[model samples]
Target chain A: MLDAVIIVLRETLEASLLVSFLFVYSNHFSVNKKWMFLALVSGIAFAVLVALQLSEISDLYDGTGQEVLFITVLLALSLLIQWINFIVIMPNYLKSNQQLLKILFSSIIVLAISLEGAEIIVFFQSSLANDNHFHANLLGSILGLGIGISAGAVSYYLLNQLANTGVIICLFLLVVVSAGMASQAVSYLMQADFIESGYPVWNTNTLIDERSVIGQLLYALIGYEATPSFTQVIVYFSYVLIPSASFIYFKIFSVRKN
Target chain B: MVLSKTGSSVKAKRLFLIHLTMLVIGIFSVDASAKRLTIEIEIKNHFFIPDKIEIPANTKIKLIVHNRDSSSEEFESYELNREKLIMGERKANIFIGPLAAGEYPFFGEFNQKTAQGWIIVK
Candidate 1:
């Protein structure tokens, strides 16, 4: 039962946190709310498709297909975040460019939800098939989902309370999330042998063992890894630095020009 | 800068295409090099058949994980930075290594207490 709770909570929290961020972005822009309908329908539908075909997927690309697909999704989300950041910073630069925003928001939701939702779909499929823990697992699943959604909701409300500042915070968060995704993508690439799995840059498992509950939560929330390779560290920092530095540089240069 | 007055869709589209090309190139390049070792680990009754396995340090390794039980389990490892879902009676391939000497722990997320194991890199 506890296993079920933890699995669902982690998966749900990961997807919902992304959704919550996009939701706030949508509110700030006054973009159409119709995207939720599209995202839900497509996300769940694709999740079911992915879950059903997962075994086949694992078999492709000399059995590195899973990592390949995972890498693509992570990188895609990161790229979309870059676009979203630009939109957030220059909302009215192109008044009629709301279409692009709509597309970005919708794509992020679909990709984020479907990737995480596939795991949940697989969990439920497995759970329903097993009679021994059906009742307990079902209860845990519900509890996990409730808590996960509630956490996302609370975060949404918190950012909303901050009003204008919330958008700024969200912009920062989106950047951080992209950095995390980049790190995760690098890990997958290393696993696939597309990139070398060099020696780890550092290890901090003693401080907060990655297997611990907090570690897992942090992993889901921020892509935390205690023993990251040198490649992963370099890529992660590049992500965090490049966008932020570019944004600040642009801001300072524009102020001077004005 | 994409939203700047001088921002052009052609450049954005080109940048997107470059990223896509690099990704596609990565996919095709998987065959450019071959791993030196392949390891098999089976999960029967929610436990890794060989709960402890060893490999040489700094060597890329391919892992074929076969699930023999009637339940699903997630193959997760913090040290190895790998995770995959293996359905009942199905198998998944997990590639790892080229690492420094040490022990890397992994577990089945669905049955953590019982489904634990380690990779000894030496």
Candidate 2:
């Protein structure tokens, strides 16, 4: 039962956190609630389709198709965040049409949710089918969902409070999250041998096992890996450092100079 | 200074994007040749049958994972970087590499305590 709870919580929290973050940010721009609703509905529907077609998807690209698709989505999301940053910085960027900007961000949020939600849905469905302890798993599932929603709410509240500090910090966090997603995609590529991973960097399994509760939370928050390969460590650090440095430079030095 | 910094960062991002795109295309093109040397493993009671599988080094091999239990399990390997969720009573296929001799450990993410296994590439 705890296993069921953990699985559902992890999956749901990942997507929910993204949703809450974006939704809270959208409030600052007065994004249309209706558009967000539509995006959420469609994202879930599309996720169902993806889950249903798992067999075919798994069979794609000689058994590495799932990783390919997953990577493509992660990269797309990363690019989308950069575009969002551009939109935010440029005045009259959407031709003074705030609605369009809102719609765009909402759609991307939907896409992120769909990808994460589909996995959770599939896991629950399969677990319910296989296990005899349905009631127990169901209870665990409910608890997981509750915890996930609470976590999202807490994040939304924190971001809302931090809005007084300006959108800079929020944007930084978003950039970090995007980088984490990209690193995860890289891991999949390395797994498929699409990318060369030279060696294991270090084993922190003794100090902090990624399977533990705190480790899982960190994984969802920032993609913590106990034992990462050489390639993964390099990519992860690059993603973290580059965007952050750029953001700080642009916000502080560039703004002051201007 | 800011403009140059942003510009340099954008260039780096673009380079990364191009590398990823090329790799994607390369994978699709090369996948055709990877459909050889099939290996089978079964899971029962959250445990992989014959948990240690030895295969020839430097060969592209197909892995067929059969999940005999009634529940689904995600076959995860940080070492191998391949993760696939195999539904109970169903079989899933995965492709693994032409590689150096090493031990690649894999386990069921859902049943990590019981479902541990390794692929020995020799």
- Of the native A-B interface contacts, what share survives in model 1? 0.67
lDDT for A179 (candidate 2): 69
TM of each candidate vs. truth: 0.87, 0.79
Docking class of 2: incorrect
Cα error, residue B86 of model 2, in Å, equals: 2.0
Model 1 C-alpha lDDT per residue in residues B1-122, reported as the tens digit of each score = 33764467777888999999999998668755553688998998778999999999888888888999877788988778888888889888777877778888899987787899999999
> What TM value does model 1 have?
0.87
Q: Which regions of candidate 1 are displaced past 4 Å?
A: A91-94, B1-35
- Mark the regions of model 2 whose C-alpha exceeds 4 Å error after superposition: A89-97, B1-38, B54-62, B69-71, B78-81, B88-90, B95-105, B119-122
Worst 10 residues of 2 chain B by lDDT: B78-87
Query: What Cα-based lDDT does every candidate model obtain?
Result: 0.83, 0.76
For model 2, name the residue pairs that clash.
B59-B98
Which lDDT tens digits does candidate 2 get at residues B1-122?
A: 45688899999999999999999999888766555688999999889998999999877777889989887788988556577777667777776766569898999877667889999998
Deviation in Å, model 1, residue A257 alpha carbon: 5.2
